[model samples]
Target chain A: AQTVTQSQPEMSVQEAETVTLSCTYDTSESNYYLFWYKQPPSRQMILVIRQEAYKQQNATENRFSVNFQKAAKSFSLKISDSQLGDTAMYFCAFPSGGSNYKLTFGKGTLLTVNP
Target chain B: DAGITQSPRYKITETGRQVTLMCHQTWSHSYMFWYRQDLGHGLRLIYYSAAADITDKGEVPDGYVVSRSKTENFPLTLESATRSQTSVYFCASSEAQMNTEAFFGQGTRLTVV
Candidate 1:
């Protein structure tokens, strides 16, 4: 069983500032995928970024990037130059490498960008 | 244009009543999943199907039943809706390929009173 943990329940960042949301997971599987999803006020889940366990290099998508430390079992999401639109509930998720396609998500970190 | 959609965006039902949430995806992904989102519990998987008629249990499968009769449709039913079952439900689908990203629906907010 894989479990994702987001220690921070809520976070706030000033506009144009950078913010990092921490995430850690426990999984025995060597091959897996880590993802960060954002749910805005519309309640639509959107993919932010994703990182594969095998890839040593971190994944970056525009302003969103991930610091994936496979050895430490840590995958953190960094939002650079945060904007108001970045204010949402961020979740860290993992998908097993095998036939299991279901995602194991963290409790989520509610991010608020103050102007 | 409709990638994925969940019917009855908001639903209200009484306890012990039977309620079904419908999910449909146009992407024709091979994998479909049902998950419940609560305040404290982010998203707990209820059930997932790899292909049509191939279903499997997830972390939280109690009190929920799922069926995938077609490749694009996966419906979740609460046999006897309880107050505990009141939460937002999200349906997602993904390709069978490993490490592929999963697409999510807008989600259905269900209230069991």
Candidate 2:
């Protein structure tokens, strides 16, 4: 079984500041993919970023980026120049059996960007 | 209209009553999944379908039933709703290709009282 862990239950960052949300996982499969999802007040699940297991270079989407450490089994999301709209619940997800057929997620980190 | 949609965005039902949640996707993705989100549990998979008529149970499938008679529709049913079953349900779809990201619906908030 694959399990994702987000140690930080809650995090806060000032407007225009940077925040990093840590995530770790345990999976037997060597080849897989990891994802970061954001859920705002509206309850919409939005994809923040995605990182492939084989890629040494991190994944970047606008102000959101992931520091994926395969050997360490760590995938952390970094949000730069944070804005008030970034306040939401962020989750780190993993695909079970190395496929999207069975996706698993972490408990999530409640991020608050205070102005 | 071009993305995945879950009907009855909010539903309230009595215990022991049967309730069904509808999910439809326009992207024709080969993989579809149903998950429940709760505090401290994040998102737990309830069921998933690889394709039309090919359904499988997920991590938390005890009191739920799902059917994928058509490629575009997968409906989840609760035979006897329980208070513990109350949570936000999400429907997602992804392409058959490996390493593809799954797209999600707005979610359905089901309350069993």
Please identify model 1 stretches exceeding 4 Å from their true place: none
User: In model 2, which regions exceed 4 Å deviation?
Assistant: A97-100
Per-residue lDDT of model 2, residues B1-79, tens digit only: 6999999999999999999999999989988999999998899999999999999989899999999989999999999
For each prediction in turn, the share of the native Cα contacts (below 8 Å between chains A and B) that it retains comes to: 0.71, 0.63
Clash totals for all candidate models: 0, 0
lDDT of 2 by residue, A1-115 (tens): 8889999999999999999999999988888899999999999999899989988999999999999999999999999999999999999998865344578899999999999
Interface DockQ per candidate:
0.74, 0.68
User: Would candidate 2 be rated incorrect, acceptable, medium or high by CAPRI criteria?
Assistant: medium
Model 1 lDDT tens row, A46-109: 9899898889899999999999999999999999999999999999988876656567899999
Cα RMSD for candidates in order: 1.0, 1.3
Q: After superposition, how far is residue A104 of candidate 2 from its true place, in Å?
A: 1.0
